[model samples]
Target: LDNNKFVETRFGKQLKPSSKSTTYDDVAENYDGQYRFAPIQEAQVSRAMIKRYFETMYDRAISDVVIVGAGSAGLTCAYHLASTRPDLKITIIEANVAPGGGAWLGGQLMTPMVIRKPADRFLQEICVPYEDEGAYVVVKHAALFTSTLLSRVLAMPNVVMMNATAVEDLIIHEDHAGQQRVAGVVTNWTLVALNHDTQSCMDPNTITCPVVVSATGHDGPMGAFSAKRLVSAGLLKELGNMRGLDMNRSEPAIVNNTREVAPGLIMAGMELSEHDGKNRMGPTFGGMIGSGIKAAHEALRVLDS
Candidate 1:
C-alpha cells in the first residue's frame, strides 16, 4: 500500500518500501568479514515479510491454543507449552507493538525487575543473569530479561506470535451436552481497536482454539477482557476486580488462584488476581511466572483430556 492507504488501514503512517532498487545485486564482495551483507530489491523485502506472516497466520487460524496478551505470563506459558508439546500449535495475540507488558518497565519506570524466590527459576531456565537477593532476585535491566524471554519463546517452532493485534471478544461455544466453553477469540488490529469508537464498522477476524489462556493483566481497556467479559455477559459468576496493592498477600493469592476459571478459559498473570479479587502485587514478578507455569500445565491437561 502507498503511504496514505497504509496510514488509513494501519491507523498510523509508516514509511513505505521504495519500489525501485538502486542496487539490485551490488555488494562489497572484496570484504571477507563474517558480517558482510548483500543488497536486494525493496519489493523482495516486503514480499518476504508478507509471505512469512501470512503463512504463520493461516496455519494458526485454527490453532490448538490462543494466548491473549503477550505479557510475562502469556509468553512464559507459551514457552513451557511449546517446550513440552511440540506437536501442538500455539499462537500468542498481543495488542501492543512490543510484548512484555509491564515487565519492560519496573516499578515507577525503573529498569530492575524483582522476582521472588521460586519464580527466579524461569529466569534461570532462560539463562538470564540476575542479582540474588535473600528472598528476591533482581534482574538489573528489565528490558534484557523481557527481550530474552521473548526471543526464546519466539524461537519455538510451534509458537506463532501475532503482535499488535487485539482480542475484541471471546468465541464461546456450547457443546451438545449444553456445556459452555470458550472456543476461541475475535480479533482485530490494535489500531482498529484503539480507534473503534471513531472508525467505521470494521469486521474483526476469528481464531479457533480448544483452549484460551487469558494473561491480559489488571489494567487497560482490554486487560482482563476475557474473564471480566465472561461475567458481564452472564456466562460466568461475579469476578471481584483486583484489590489494593498488598505484595505479600497478593503474590501467593495470584499464584494459587491461577487456574481454569471456565471450561476452556484459563486466567493467568494479573488477570487471575482480578478474577479472584486478590491483592495486587505491584512490580514483583514471581507470581506472574508461577501463574504462567500453572496455566501452561492446565492447558496441556485440558488438551490431553
Candidate 2:
C-alpha cells in the first residue's frame, strides 16, 4: 500500500498520492538523499578555459597566414584556406576571450542574424540551418550558427586559434622594389592593451608571416595601423576627400575588390571598406564571407607567383 501511494515509476507508472500530503521538508529531504550536489568553482572553470587557449598560443608561435580578427570573415577565410591549402599553417588572433566576434551575440544579443539569398551557399556548405524569408535567409539560431562555424574552423588541423590576444603593431619591411610590405605583427594580451598598461608597449611578442589578412571588421585597426606606417615611410600618399563616394552604392565593389592594399598585407571583410574608403554594409553576412573567400584565393595566388 505504501509503495503504491508513495512512489512513481518512469515507465508511466504513477502511484496514487498518499493520504498524508508530502510536505516541503519531506520532498527536500528526498531530493537531497537521491542526488549529491556539488557546484563547480568559478576559478576552476576559468583556469581550464585559459589553459586550453594558452597552450595553442604557445605551440604555434608562427603561421603562414595570420588572421587578425576571428569574426565570420576571418573564420571563413581560415576554413577555406585550410580546405584548399592544408600544408599552410593558419593562425587566428582574437582580442576577445571567446571567438565569433559580433556573431556570437547577434545584434546586441537580441536579434537574429540575416544573410542575403546569395549567401545561401555558404550556409549550406557549413551545414547551418537557415530558411528563406523573402529577400534574405535568416539563420535558425545566431549562437548555433556562430558556434558551428567556430567548430568547423577549430576542427581543421592547420588552424590555430589564439583568443584574448590583441594585434598591437605591424612589422613592415621594404621589399627590393622599395615598397613597404607587412612582414609580421606585434601582439600582447588583450587585458594589457585594454588596461593601457605601459608594459604592453614594452613587453610584446611578434608573429612573422609572409601574408597577413586584416579582417579587423569595419574599424580596420590593421589597415589604419598599416596606412600610418606606409605614409610615414613615404610609400603611400595621403588619402584625399571621400565625401563624394556613396558607401551604400559601393558595397558590390567592396565585396569584389578585397585585394592586397599593401605589399604582403591583404584586407578582407569590412577592412576592405576601411582600406579603400568604400561604403559600409550594415549587418551583411554575404559580403563578409565572400570577402574572406576572395582574400584566401588572392593570398594563394600571391603565394604561387
TM-score each candidate. Answer: 0.87, 0.75
Model 1 Cα lDDT, one tens digit per residue, 1-305 = 54453322111233455577645233333554333667799999999999999988888989999999988889888888888888999999999988999889778989899999989888888889999998999999889888988887887768889989999999998899988899999999999988888967988999999999999999577788887888976877888888999999998888788888988999899988778888998999898889898999999989989
Model 1 clash count equals 0
CA lDDT of each prediction against the hidden true structure: 0.86, 0.74
Model 2, residue pairs in steric clash: 247-279
* TM-score, predicted candidate 1 vs. hidden true structure: 0.87
For candidate 2, write residues 190-233 as lDDT tens digits: 88766665544457888988898878765433334444444565
Q: Among these predicted structures, which one has the highest lDDT? A: 1
